[model samples]
Target chain A: DQQVKQNSPSLSVQEGRISILNCDYTNSMFDYFLWYKKYPAEGPTFLISISSIKDKNEDGRFTVFLNKSAKHLSLHIVPSQPGDSAVYFCAADTTMGNQFYFGTGTSLTVIP
Target chain B: EPEVTQTPSHQVTQMGQEVILRCVPISNHLYFYWYRQILGQKVEFLVSFYNNEISEKSEIFDDQFSVERPDGSNFTLKIRSTKLEDSAMYFCASSERPRYASTFRTDTQYFGPGTRLTVL
Candidate 1:
């Protein structure tokens, strides 16, 4: 019953490089997708989100790309820094539903 | 800078005991939700409340679980006669708009630092 999935459990990137985390969903009913960054012992912080109608959305150094056809979405961080290291969770919601479905999460480590 | 907040950062209770987890959502937010994640599992939705009533709930939220906005600013989740399998990190979240709102911009959610419930 895993509607959303993050195949990669962990990823590492060098400082000033690009770090990409990917997520996939099986439910076509999900009309919105979002990415959240979570630090150890803290709550998840909303990073960015994209509507199913759009393919890409960018905010500062973070960008999210959505491919409805593939039912895939990704979060990309440019010029990665140590502060960017954290577990990233991908969540999706249906237009008619209030609950969000979340992935297991992908841990990203940006080495300085 | 208003944010969701939860009490009893960690609660250790024995099986068959009732435990109440509390939360205070942002003042102006209109929606409140509860979610949990067992160690090593994905975050799972428990219930969503609006207008003082539950809008939706998952299969995991059974007869033993209930949510209430006891007051304007406080939201609570109560688990009756807890089971060992109920051990998990419970989170409270708030959103400014409902998913069906015409202006919905993904209805961004603000989450509180979770409460770790350990049932022995």
Candidate 2:
């Protein structure tokens, strides 16, 4: 079963606009969420992460908001840039261990 | 900055042949892991190792697969016999601690570029 899911396979946003990506999870045991960005033929690069204790975490133009009651989370990029274009993957970690469950990923395109 | 590195960026092997994928995690990182992504699929966890022993492994990690931390610097994944279905991009990651909240150098994992293995 896919405990973590990213229903949207692709998303597009114009440069200088906001880009939002959504992720949902079925496992309540997961407490830590992370986002990773990847390019073709390269391993995933760490983006941003949020802990269960907080509802939101922001770094620079990237922000992650978590809604525990809804079992959902999202990543938002303001004033999106072409460099931000890449496949974004959402991952969840359960208390059992540090191993992560990753979503299929959503490809984001920042159109100029 | 230190980063995880994998050897033989690409490998093509015949079915039923043995193939060994190698990785060298960042120095001083205590925890190690292996994850695989089939083309057009999500990344799946394979195994995690610490203190020279396998701490945890997924159901996908069967008898045919084994992991070793030989000596000090090298971590290897060996598939006793290759299968056409074994083809995928394999990534090696390492973290300094066991908690996800820790920094990649301390808690989060730093991933290698990845090794693409194709079994014919």
Candidate 3:
């Protein structure tokens, strides 16, 4: 099931620069979207999320923007640090289904 | 800062062997889930459990796979007969949401450090 997809397999950015990670979903019924960061040998860590009613949601240095009409979403991280290097995954779900669909993660590399 | 925990960070078993991976969800959480990610592949959902019963499962969760909450704290996934293709990382997650509540759009899931299972 390719409901959610992350076209970019890798991203590189200089430290202190803005990093943008993109994700796309094919399902229109999805009402909830989330971004997760994962480190090697560890579970994914929840970053930020956006609801269908809101076009954007921000948490500290992280922000998630959603375009329901385009079935696309993006996560932006500013002042990227070397510690920010990890895999980011985009996920979507239809709320009531209680099941989540995930994208093949994008690995981010922050060069110091 | 309570977090979910899993046992046996890594396990290597022979084919046809029965392997049981264990997880302990955070207290007060009612929903439990299992997901696996093969190397270089997307994370796939396996099953979800609530109220001591399975709420939903995926096609990959065939007859060979089973889940149980034998006690109050522990949730386990038992693979009846391990196959060579079963090598992957298994993650356990839990969410705090009342089953009957409908106003909320979704429940945030907290994941535990995955257990890497290697089947020979």
Residues A1-112, candidate 1, lDDT per residue (tens digit)?
Answer: 9999999999999999999999999999998988989998888888988889899999999999999999999999997999999999999999888888999999999988
The Cα RMSD in angstroms, rounded to one decimal, for candidate 2 relative to the true structure is: 1.4
Q: Chain A of candidate 3: what's the TM-score?
A: 0.98
> Where does candidate 1 clash, by residue pair?
none
> What's the lDDT for residue A56 in model 3?
93
Clashing pairs in 3: none
Q: Candidate 2 has what TM-score?
A: 0.97
Which regions in candidate 3 have their CA more than 4 angstroms from the true location?
A: B98-106
Q: What is the DockQ of candidate 3?
A: 0.62
Q: In model 3, what lDDT does residue A21 have?
A: 98
As a TM-score, model 3 comes out at: 0.96
Expressed as tens digits, the lDDT of each residue in B30-101 for candidate 2 is: 999999999999999999999999999999999999999997999999999999999999999998888754
